[model samples]
Target: MNARLSGDEKRGGACGTDNAGLTTSTGPRPRRRPPVPEESHLLKNAAIALAAAGTLLLASCGSSTAPSGGGRSVVDAAPCARSTAPEAQGMPSTERIFGWIEDLVGIGYRRTGTLEGEKAAAYVKCQFESLGLQDVHYETAKSWNWSATRSRLKVNGEAVDSFPVAHTYVTLDQPSVFSTGPDGLTAEIVDVGAGVPLQSVQGKIVMFDLKFLMPPALLALQIEFLWDPGLTTLEPTLVIGNPFVTSYATAVERAMEGGAVGFIGVLSDYFDSNKYYNEFYRRTQVTIPGVWVTKKEGARIRQMMGGGNRSANLVMEGFRKEATGRAVVGFLPGKSKDTIMVQSHHDSVFYGAVEDGSGTAAVLAQAQYYASQPAESRQKTMMFATFDTHFSGYQVHREFVRKYVIDKETPYNIVANVTLEHIGKQGIKGADDQLEITDKPELRAIIENMGPTLKLGMINSVIRHDLRRTALISGHVLCPIGALPTDAGFICAAGVPTASLIAGPNYLYDAADTLDKVAKDDLVPVTKVFIDLIDAIDATPTALIGLPLKSPLYESGAQD
Candidate 1:
């Protein structure tokens, strides 16, 4: 018998009055020393002294609240306190897992379909196998084919070094030259504020300061927010400097279709020579001739553009092709033979230590830990999958879900489909809206209990990610969209009930997303949360009563 929750059934009180699970702490927990007024005054004096010593600071220091009778400062009081089981230990260790991630980053950029990418896949496969996972395999999918040869910029015949942003278009032999129009192609420099508005950018290279100087998160968020709305109306033929926009593909397509001659993206000031060189050589192509200018060079160009240096030369060279990528798959069978799927993508844009490497590691570790459990402890069959081509059309995911998941004729019902994306960062920001489906109260209870253990918040409303697709198809409750820096939130669009864990190291896509960004302390807790969630789901009785068996005639046909 096939058992599933109807759309209406799934829309009930999944987020009921589980106030017992909620904490009412209004401030941060106190674990250390009480506040000292005298010390605060001394610190203020010290700050003034330091400033007099020719140092400038931008500190947001504040006065501390008086201590309570218990000798704990108001600022140091615990906001939320809950009882823990005596035998229950904290979540799994993220440090050990990050060590493995560091080793993977050491392998360099795992561009889709490359030898390095495949080798990385193999290493991941081995890791899963070592964890005792069964039927481990790789699935190939298509990826964009493009590579960069060389990029350079020149002003007044002076050569400048440049970096190539990923997915930016490059021209092979044609170098684009810019000139101010009317007589010599001259236009007044205009600060279009945020570059989202391109109404007045016609016939001139629109310049903006969207390049993030410190943390790339600011830029990533700006780009993600702007690209979806700005791309359609902004019609600048040429754009200069990284405006913190989406994929270079979008910019290139816009510029090309808009009749823009060329683009000059400014590299972030945080670019490391070694890292940039490593990542630059690892560039993949999309559609246009775009190049990255160094911070210094970009500054010079900005000055020249400001000073009416209308005649500037830019050139980019590259080509695109249709390439193939792969997704890895493995399975662990259970008593009922029904499948409960767990998935994370293996491919990445850069080193991707946090974007998804952390998620991948978590899934692999959970599979290992669960497989190590005694056979009697197992309940439903577990499907472990690492999808590919997530960055492109989400081809592999769509194919897999359509074929092996939804199309299966057996009584192999999908109890839960958990998809992990980016989960190695701190601070969870859920989607703008809550899912309309009703959640299984039992599942919500487990999640609530696990939240404190994992240092996570059980948010009712959040954005959709990879698992959203499955939710749409299966209509399962408890759908979660993992927190990350990117738009990997479309998973819930498919209607799969999902829940995501947030533990990312930093904003994704930028060079700052190295293995070092992942917090060692956060890993294990996130892992434990996933493991606990799986256990809870597996323990839930399937809504159905009978299990389907394969027939001898079907077996014979399969053999033939």
Candidate 2:
């Protein structure tokens, strides 16, 4: 039966792509290009270009090989040996995708707009160059950044381990063992559990178990579910109420408003939520020296100063500055002036092996697949981009539109968009890293370690980027209409056609999103469907590629 979708479904759930052509072992053999004067010129220019980009290359040719992710060159790049001659039927390879994973996540945590982020972008550029893509270059823009240099906490004259919350602002010097810097004052600890009182914690360090409030619409949905007990299916939305994703900044603001010297975040899920988790956000003016601790740590501090006046020291030195971030883009000319733009953000919060490294690897796989195919197979020009500033406000995507799409800066009319994110790792829904056992014996027997299923969005783009072709094709296979606007909203808002495939994993913004969290063998199914979608987009006519744009809810000319 075809999946019947309503407007209520939001983000993720299990679905099927088990159809003909989704997994065909054989495909049409591509035609090769005859060597000619133009081909000779192109080959010569490509060699010259690769020679010039040696300084920007990932590493030297003679670099020693190391184990996967252990800091050795995985493979020598074929930058100067791209042939226009057609290869066999090309598709994304899972093994090579994992190699790309080891390549990026092996580097380290790559927060947006940082030096590490720039280095990651450079690697992406090199990968594109190795794939024989032309016009591979870095598109850079200056953006604000945030970092936590040091944070210390002491209880009852004893030092305790602590970490600063990401994206929160702080500048407190260690004045004394019991008192913080110029901003903090001597006072007893306040155990304000998830509730903030503006006047109660004055001159005190307010440590609360960070509270998570679901966005209003999702809240109502859950209430309705309880009201109607027989309602079997859930709305396909990302509705988990986690404070790290939805509450960290708001709680900090409330604490600062209450005139607290420093703020402490007691992790809501001490068993699961790692204390090293970062609250990734844009730079905001209303920031306070904020640190997070486990629930056990909170309990220890509460016991230390029971019903008596005692002071504890808190120091936070956060790094904030404007830095240049780089985005890599490469072009493969096709049969038409129209374009298909495919992208994924490479910047990560921690090791980011999964939150985005998986997505980045998927993009690399797609690039390699496309490069291996004959250029004549493409009906539209293809632009592959690895973006930065994902943990930020997606400023890079916004800027790319303003300068190139809306500015009429380029000749290619980008008719479609294909975006990929977080397609690795089946979620183990318990604290001890165990699979959630169901009450029904039958269900448990058949369950396996499967990565979180992909959520394919079947929406027309509202803005500058067009990703509709890939999405429309997926609709015929497994695309559903309930995908939330986590990433595509920016492009869709611009009236572009877009297709997005993502796995809304719980550890998306946490340090626990390490390489190990990524699924080793689950990428094949997702890639198989992805290749089919690309073919569909290439064959579909432009007139039917996207839905007619719906009228805006409010006029842009009107002020708020």
Candidate 3:
């Protein structure tokens, strides 16, 4: 979920320079790193570093031991009312929240650094202004803008449906993995299956299988940790789509090192469709040119390959340049200086009705609710934000963390964060091997890094709202990233207690994530739960809110 690339040199170039230069009725704004050879190498280094650090931290830590960056202990801080359930008096209605989703999805594919992305940011800013929120502005960061204008794969001069792999650096102006002009790359095709072939494939096109870790297989390994609140049948409903999980990136690296001119991926576990828009590339300087094909199409291509010697033409044309990444921000003043930030990203690969359209709606709902109340009613100020660059990279996220939370650049102090994402239906690979989306709400988690009191409050809120199939999962439990896996994961690691509600569905990154994908029925309930959570946090003292260093789920050192 994190964008690994750093733009230290190119950052702040367009921090306040909006392409449209349209000022809000109110007004203005504000604003990385090493060069890695390949994305695979970069990811390997990151994984090793994170894993080693986690092991070391877990080895010396106990279950009750809090991390170094945490606030005062429960013994020293004032306690909050834990037995009572929060009221949803001012929460937005389901129609109001879902309407935001419809409006966002209407502005097709808001990929970061594009005109559509800017439009999305503008829309969020307008929402904040409509609520009369103060200091509505755009916080910008640099992004490596890449968009595929056209991509094609032809076998024996016949066209085969294909989509360019997200963020693969393919251009004619630079020294990328496969640099071709309008003629494109014409070469012999070789099938490498799931393994990285050792045979010389110099100047040839490599075709390899890309596997996704099925939810069923993942549940078989970690079923004990999975908690369902008696919502529905607990079946495998999501797939681990990270290419790194299945070593697809490694295969691409090996192919590149083996002198392959280009590559084609057979989506072995995809839902019999090819319009896959995976953003796991993390904006690394990857130069490989690749496209994804469906399982059925892959089978046909394999059959064609068996006939005789054949050549294929791979054409992928896209623009890669420096672009601005924005984060729309505003604040609601309260009696206290402590701030509880409500956040979600506005950028998406496709329609993203659930990937984050639902999340943006959640943020809007919270903002609308809070702003409607008098300032004296709120104990802590609320910061409402919808970030960009989620799909491109996390540069904007990092920038916000640096300038706002870590640096305390603003007058308000951010004591906690609540992030919402992917409120959608449960999806699974059906009996016929097709993607089946169910009507029930997705089994989700409120990944939290809070103390005992706050944790109990979250559990109570979930139950009170009848948010079935949802659990209060510890943020530190078996997560590859040190904190929660949601957008608030980074902030949680920064030691501000965070509760991020999220779910993983099969169509999260695909064009199939339409308006119908959002769990419209649960919109009001989900918003109410967060409303209860924020009220609980505001009531509790900051000192007792966080648990910086908690033990992993297993003593064996795999963190959640």
Candidate 4:
């Protein structure tokens, strides 16, 4: 995640910086004010603002509308093939994309290692089967199931607000709980900074008050934007992690290393409104027993620190045994062994309509499109792979690579990999996790009022590095390959050129990422572009798709 794009700041979004949910790598990355980094405390638009160097390439504006920055037209410089924009052509019905999204959402959430995950897998299998594709089947993998069946909390014999974190356990079955009462956990409560120092919280029940504060640079940039809306004076910088992928588990891990007995992270004002009931990191394991509390509850706990009756209790049970994960694979044969793999993660924290439902739909939609094409239309093999355990760290992707791409000496001949991620929205998240949709020029609101955080991030990330390009015009094809840890990360690590198509949604990793969060109409262009991506790569000679191995991050050996 420390990789730099030429002269830009180090953006982990393209690399495997976790929080890989979408707003898409660990979980989807959240959106910020603009180009200003998330730590800048400025605003959401600032993160995307950095791309404003007047060379902004917008997908919604189409090629007809040439985006002008610095009084210049960039339509001619776009990477898309002007002769034939196959990926941008043949738009699909919004209803079809919406229907797939709704069906996946209808099955509740698609969290990995859960029944919901399997259901989603089955549905994807059915979709591939209905398309009349060849050799469609389920690919099984394995991962630990860190389920939170029961978590009870109390303060001085009085029940209080609390919920168990994903892997807040000591052992798989005998994980410890947090309780403070006459007979429960009666340690001295220590109120400290975000991640309490080792000396400050050693041997105590550390309480970390969380604050979604932006960095100083972002804060200053945001103030500047308030004074100017059109904002042509400053260059657009790269947006930091939309929400800056803060991990409670990582914070708790630090606390544990500091000698703390128990840990509790209090949600800030941001979560109180935008994501009050978020269950983060359910797909990943935790090293310590932990839970989250509201800001109000945190204050109360802090106030009771010195009180004689101050105490609490946490009882968490129901740690399930290891589980079997599944991945759905479908292939449309071509004349040769050269394979172009297109994938998306089916597992999500919530319904994840935009976070990944849109991605899955894009894959299916592309399948439908290619299926309609003549058999000889494709010269290389096209694969639609929807994976699970993405929440647990892209295990399905790794397994697929090992079996299909690297099993034999000659390999499966996978030349290019495309990952379909969060798409079709109209907003980016700002300070306090606020959704700002009405302000920016890059944010294309496909479904009316909602924002397209994921799409917006993608536009800025892949194109911002191109110093010569300015606007995203018609036939402006971008090389999707990068150093980011995307769904195609495993394949890319194996030296196969990869491109990840995703956007940031404000509530990507939480339950709030529901059906309404997705802009149905936006799906048309996102899917169309995806089609063109497949067509573009397939039509190009394998040697031309640029695969940059600039950093060790390109080495794909880890699970995600």
Worst 10 residues of 3 by lDDT: 24-33
Whole-structure CA lDDT of model 4 = 0.53
Candidate 1 residues 1-560, lDDT tens each? 12443221111111101111011111111111222223433344443344333111111010012223356432222221111221111232444455445444543455665544554565455455544567666666555444454455566555657655444543332223222222222223333322332453444443333343223222232221111122321322112222223333334344454445455555433232212321211123333444565445667776776656555455555444455666677777789876677777766656666656776766766765666667667788887877656554455655554455446544455555566655433311123311111111000011111222221221211111111101111112222222122222223323333444432222355444555445445456556556766776677665431122222322233211
lDDT for model 3, please. 0.67
Off by over 4 Å in 3: 1-89, 170-179, 214-233, 238-246, 308-310, 477-483, 549-560
lDDT per residue (tens digit) for residues 455-504 in model 4: 34334433332211112211111122332434655665556666554444
What are the per-model numbers of colliding residue pairs? Answer: 60, 24, 9, 86
lDDT per residue as tens, model 2, 144-245:
567655677776677766787766553332111222354433455666777665465667777878654542234242121121122321422234443334
Output the number of the lDDT-best candidate.
Answer: 3
Ranking by lDDT: 3, 4, 2, 1
Estimate the lDDT of model 2: 0.52
Question: Can you write out model 3's per-residue Cα lDDT over 1-560, one digit (the tens) per residue?
Answer: 13331231011011111111111111110110111223334344454454345323422221111222345321111111111111222566676577677656655567886655765776676556655578877788887567777778899888899989877854433423334557778999989888786888999899999876434334344332334556354443443452214556778888888888889999887786787787644523457688899888888898888889668898877777777888888999988889999999988887678979899989988886787678888888899998887766677887787688667798889888899999999777676558788878777777777778877777777777778777666664533245345777556656667888877777787877877778888998988889888988888888888764423322332321
Model 1, residue 147: displacement in angstroms? 1.9
Candidate 4: how many backbone clashes?
86
Cand. 3 TM to true fold: 0.77
Candidate-wise lDDT, in order: 0.42, 0.52, 0.67, 0.53
Worst 10 residues of 2 by lDDT: 441-450
Candidate 3, residue 141: CA error in Å? 0.3
Question: Candidate 1: deviation at residue 196, Å?
Answer: 5.1
